[model samples]
Target: MFKKFVLATSLAAMALSGAHAAEITFDEAIAGATVFEFDGDGDMVVDVRFGTDDPEGFNTVGPGANQTYISEPGLEGTTLLDTDLFVEFLGGAVGTLSFGFATIDPDTSVNFTVYDDNDNVLGSTTALATFDTGGDFPEALASVSFAGLASYATFDFFGVGSRYIIDNFNGTFGSTEDRTPDAVPVPGALALFAPVAAGLFARRRKAKK
Candidate 1:
């Protein structure tokens, strides 16, 4: 009986250890601190800017103007600003991308795509919302998996050209590499040896008698 108890305890410990593994959060990701400029390639220009009109005027664009243009002429139709943020997971595990965006035109649709380092689209989603017209902000969230991705090195975010005001943009990737262990009882293995343990115990009890 003591031996059986020890075996069970060891199994339980193993399971618990597996379940308690640590996982990487979005903030811990290396690409989390990166901020990409839309249309910074000087190819196409878009009339969009970021930041408040506070005294600090901490805007992404130059002075006097609240909007910045892509300035790229080749990018005429469907102007999209794309940035490649590299992220790598050491272990081969499932990973997810979580992101949220606020837009001005609630009626217009926006497309978000996740791409590998090679520029292949792994996943994409489009959000359509009714225009508030009152200038209120509407938010949307999307998540994607890292399975079958060309490479885990980089992910891309493509913003569809529209008068969309984006704020509070955040992204996070989660992985199962840090899942807590599950204590699964090995009933089959235990049953296979149960008869032997029972026989030994009976023999010992008979000797005592």
Candidate 2:
């Protein structure tokens, strides 16, 4: 009985190990998606909130040198002025974050604000992401690292009348997958195995009596 319990627990641990810091390259078929969620650990979750500034929201834009990337098309009849993305980490925090971004105009800039778990501002930065003649809009990368763990972050396009796109999200948290439209939550495998292990323990105790 003990051996069976140990085996079940080990299998569940392996499943949980699958959750790790993930980098999103925007290579998947996420043409018309909005919210991207990543299961970092069994207890926490990470969400890259996007698609709030334009009519097209978050969609694949081009097949440039870097292939397809995510962007918000500020089409007509839209009040959207600037492109923005919010990365929120729930139940946990990270110390490092990086991603690639680009703008419609050359020599555009982007602004970032990072916060801690208590909603306190940790640091802010402005990165200049230029348009490459050969690569796509996401040709330049923006990276940030702080001494304290970060709970959330905000990125905004600072160029006047210009929009931006992002791709290749690298972080120090868990990994993620292409979640088009909606993403279903997946906790650690231990949640599933816990019940089985408990049942087995109960049976073993009864037999011992």
Cα-based lDDT at residue 113, candidate 2 = 77
For each candidate, what TM-score against the reference? Answer: 0.33, 0.55
lDDT of each: 0.35, 0.55
Top candidate (lDDT): 2
Worst 10 residues of 2 by lDDT: 70-79
Tens-digit lDDT string for candidate 1 (1-209): 99999988886874454322222211211121232223211234311121221222211211111212111111111112332233332222223444333333344445555555566666666654332322234444444544443233322333432433322222221232332122234689789989999999999999999
Which parts of model 2 have CA positions greater than 4 angstroms off?
Answer: 1-21, 39-55, 66-83, 131-138, 175-209
- Per-residue lDDT tens digits of candidate 2, residues 1-209? 99999988886764454322455555444454555564432334444433354435565554355423233321111113443667775433455567666666566676777887787887777777654435555345677766566667877766542556666666555533222111223457668988999999999999999
